[model samples]
Target: MPVFADVDTGVDDAMALVYLLASSDANLVGIASTGGNVDVDQVCRNNLGLLELCGATAIPVSRGADQPLSAAMRTAEDTHGPAGLGYAELPLHQRELTGYDSAEAWVRAAHAMPGELIGLVTGPLTNLALAVRDEPNLPSLLRRLVIMGGSFDYRGNTTPVSEWNISVDPEAAAEVFDAWGRAADAKVIQQHQLPIVCGLNLTENIMLTPTLLSRLAAASGATTTAMSVLDSRGTRSTADNTLIRTLEDAMRFYFEFHFDQGEGFLAHLHDPLAAAVALDPSLVQTRAATVDVELTGTLTRGMTIADWSHRWGRESNAHVGVGVDPAAFFDRFIERVGPFARRLQADR
Candidate 1:
């Protein structure tokens, strides 16, 4: 299956990229960059650098939306670190970026693949919204859209009522959700499967535990069986010696953020979980809902209002992720990418 990723190149985004590269099923066609974690330029660079680090540079990279459709840009530098990769730094990409911008990349890739492209979007919906505006028939073209945004069950991460990705560009999210829910022409009502949303409600459950980290932090030189967790492991200090140190460095800030949130040395692996669910829909248990974004509200602006009841008489446009198998997801990630993990103590 052809998989397309739209990312902000945050720490978790990098993890998703690597996971996709390592996956046996991922025929990754291209990656489109958008502004959220840092900016579109840095997102492109980060995407390229990760592809290079994973030895998957053959994948094309496209730079997209420097800002939201109609809102001022906000970045997660504090959460993702200054460079967006946390502590790890990657070699500057030698290959030139793809000519198509983010919007163009989404449109072109979808058209080329027709109804076979499975998209995982892990950032603000700026690029997607722009693509929809350019190609009104975009919703009907994609095989599936799995978005890592919104917060329906609990409090939001950014605001009292909004999650970071959706809060950053609610208008764009609104357009994307509405597009999938209803066709471009009002007379033509399409019953599209609601985009699967791995929102805060579902993502908060996939926390990074010490055991998971220890398994992933094993030296690439270590001999192991398939999906085997090394009986003996290196200390946290020596974890930087692993090839996946780049991800380790990035998680420093994430760990700290989680600590501040009273989560205790654990960071919710949000984007990667979205990517996992996208590639394998069975990874998450979902409930269909008529989902929409709040573009104008005094306190609930950017909030994703999901009507679970049939009172709205609206078609369900989003499959709200309600449950996930954390262990299965983590195991799959390690099994696919662990072989490529090596020792690298470099922070920069």
Candidate 2:
């Protein structure tokens, strides 16, 4: 079983958690919330509520940094809504309080594990930066870190040059990259690879297809009904109707913000693709290259510069995902979620 540590602050991040729960392969050890799309407190609250909705109350939830290390804090409230949950008005569910401080807790958990654990990050790398600094051996303890941030050649959602996660805290991201580079230098990890980066270039290749939508709808109905019955709740709020509701809301916001100004009906699942990559690397096309984060370029602060030229003679420090097989990815996604869908129906 693999333990996953996620630092999330977006509605899509919540949907990613639901996907992880539905997948039997991911042994979710804990979740750490950070302030990116919303305040730190709200992110923590949303994490608990989402875990409860998915019936994953046993999983520990922790709170992380409230702001960036050195940069002015910024958020995507317009895209994720005021609460970072698509503006869906629903009462917060009561749950047990988190037991540890987020940053320190993450460091402790990583060290306590027998071996390196899978790290999944969907927000700014602030918490990770702090963890590496606090625990000198933290980077070595990570089996792998799959980050859903940055853009290689595609258009960015934040600015013309930067992605939201990286833009939120470029300084922190820089530190993380540097730390990982040092760890890779110390040991020759498997496959002669550095950090595996699932940037926008690959995630954009995965779009919401009609078939995928239909499967999601079916699963949504069954899960909603099962949850309602199990909880003894007579009625399900329209806002809390199904897990797909969160996905739908995220797609709506993403499309409006990026492609159609809110008129488009669907958007690609960027974060989910990152999660899928963590589960199986063969699903994507990866190339090892020396990658650097631009922290001073006025128009490209958060941009990841991959030295593909090989002209500069820089050693490759990261594995950059360049492409993906969309058809195969869709098949795997549906295949994994199908069992969960069937289980939901059978339970009903």
Candidate 3:
């Protein structure tokens, strides 16, 4: 089985968490939240609420960094709403807060596990960076690091060149990439231990299909009901309605808030696709490359530079996902999430 370490602060991040909770292949050790879409405190609360919603309250939730490594912290409230979860009012589930620091919890979890554990990062890399700095052996303890960040060839949703997660913490991202490079170069890490980046290029292929949304609507419990009511009241739009309309009208404006300059009926399910790739690598097309984070450029602060030129001819440290079989991936995702949806809906 695979143990998980999550760093999240997005609405979609909650969906990804729920998916992991439902998946049989994943054993959630602990969760660490970083400041991205909201404040660190809110992200922690959201993480706890998500676990309760998924009936995984036994899992521990910890708060992470409130700001980025260097630059001023930014948030995506315009897209994810004020409270995250699209302002949907979920019923409160009382949970006894854990006493462990989020980063410390991660280290402890790694130590407790018999072997390497997977680090599935769905948000900014701040917490992971802190963990690496605190515990130098953390990377070696990890079986793999599947990160949802960056953009290779596609235009970014945050900026013309920057993806949200990387844009939020470029300094931390640089550190993580460098560490992965060092470990891979030394051959101290297994082939699967290298970081697998599920960037916007691959995630853009996985759309929230109508059938899947219908399944989610049917699967979600009181949370879905509350969301539907909120959608009706115009507080937010349901994923089903937003996705269907985007596909139908070709406007594609459900999640795009930074740049309103796209013509195709496509929105990247960036975080969920990352989780899917972590669950099964066969869903994507991968190529090994020396992926670097651009931190000092005037216009490319968070751009992910995949060294595909083969000039230096260095051993590839990163597995960059270039493409995905959207049909096959979505089918598998629906198949896996479908039962959980039904069970959750029934529980409600």
Total clashing pairs for each candidate:
5, 1, 1
Better of 1 and 2 by TM-score: 1
Count backbone overlaps in model 2. Answer: 1
TM-score for model 1? 0.90
Predicted candidate 3, C-alpha RMSD: 4.7
Estimate, for each residue in 1-348, the C-alpha lDDT of model 3 and write its tens digit: 565756665557766776677788888878887888777887888777767666788988887876887889988776666776554544477885568766777787777773557788988988888878887777778777899988887778687898989998999999998888887778777778888999988887777643455554444321222222112223343333322221212111233331333423224467777787787877788888888888898988899889887676766778999988887866666666666755765565
Residue by residue across 308-330, what tens digits does model 2's lDDT show? 87665755667888889887876
How far does residue 221 in candidate 1 sit from its true spot (Å)? 4.6
Compared with the true structure, all predictions reach lDDT values of: 0.81, 0.70, 0.71
User: Which 10 consecutive residues of model 2 have the lowest summed lDDT?
Assistant: 225-234
How do the residues 1-348 of candidate 1 rate in per-residue lDDT, one tens digit apiece?
899899999988998887787777888899999989897788888988887777677989998877898999999888887878877778766988987798999999999987788888999999999998999888878888899999986899999989999999999999998898776235343433358999999998889865576677553443323211232221123343444556666766677667767877768999999988888999999998888899889899999988998678977787898988888988888777676565222322
Clash pairs for candidate 2: 256-262
Task: State which candidate, 1 or 3, has the greater lDDT.
Answer: 1
lDDT of 1 at 339: 61
